[model samples]
Target: MQIVVKDLAFGRINMSIEKDIQQQTFRNSYQKATVNIIFSANWLTEQIKIFLDEEHITPQQYNILRILRGSMKPLSTLQIRERMLDKMSDTSRIVDRLVLKELVEKKLSTADK
Candidate 1:
């Protein structure tokens, strides 16, 4: 693994995978496989989060925008909330922020009536 040191205080963090794991510690292959997969997923998520930090948006917010863009239709706050991967307690607040950014708009459809 290739490590990157961001701060001299916190020590080094892994930034890339340069080597493959050749040894297994567990007797149960299935359990070991599952653990390895989950560990890899979390590691990947952390790497992505580091990249996303530059954008000043959380992963949840990114997901919401992706969902809204995919819909191509004006989605109500409730609809957007329902489609979000992260069920935020304040969907209105999130939508409001997106609206402020001009990334999304809020409009009442006839169905709302």
Candidate 2:
């Protein structure tokens, strides 16, 4: 079943997940909610990609920039990777690219030196 409701705050009509995905049935509410969450996340990612594309940066690079911007001090590649949304990304390689772009700089810590 599809439910359409007026969104008072946004002054828009909101459609049910069923209508959005064009699927009318699920195993249960939990399954429906899971699908909704995944679908919403993907939609949001696409929206973000559109904006990020103009800046000539990938989502992973943007993630690193945000991480660095918010940190009180410089962080290592491992630290940045731990805080990244996509942990599986190659943080070192992204950082190297950022260095090439002059978006971020790399420094050797006293301990590493």
Candidate 3:
């Protein structure tokens, strides 16, 4: 993996990517872009993981919190899944964990009836 380092207004920032996964360079622009997007996602995930670890929360739980906070209102499990980065995630299970931690509150939505 190549850790690209760059200097910005804040200071030097580093992003890690898996370069060893493929020995040859990308065959085309699309291929390169695909790898770049995955790399960026993973890098972002790592940053989020480090921050959430201190709060004793998993990345999935942290993601749910962000979605709920962004809505500024309560959301149903289906609604949360629709808004999440990983739509395939088990919103109900993840919410249960967050609710256990007091990081989230869940109530039966009016629409659920």
Report lDDT (CA) for all predictions.
0.67, 0.82, 0.71
TM-scores of all predicted structures: 0.68, 0.74, 0.61
Residue 4's C-alpha lDDT in candidate 3?
Answer: 27
Candidate 3 has a TM-score of: 0.61
lDDT of 1 by residue, 18-106 (tens): 23345436668686777677778887688768765765666776767777767857777788789887775478887777678666667
User: Model 1 off-target regions past 4 Å?
Assistant: 1-24
lDDT of 2 by residue, 1-113 (tens): 11122322323434588988899999999999999999888877776777677667899998899889888889998899999999899999999998988899899999766
The candidate with the higher TM-score, 1 or 2, is: 2
Model 2: CA > 4 A from native: 1-14
**Positional deviation of residue 23's Cα in model 1 after best superposition, in angstroms:** 8.0
RMSD of each: 8.5, 9.2, 8.0
How many clashing residue pairs, candidate 2? 0
Over all chains combined, what TM-score does candidate 1 have?
Answer: 0.68
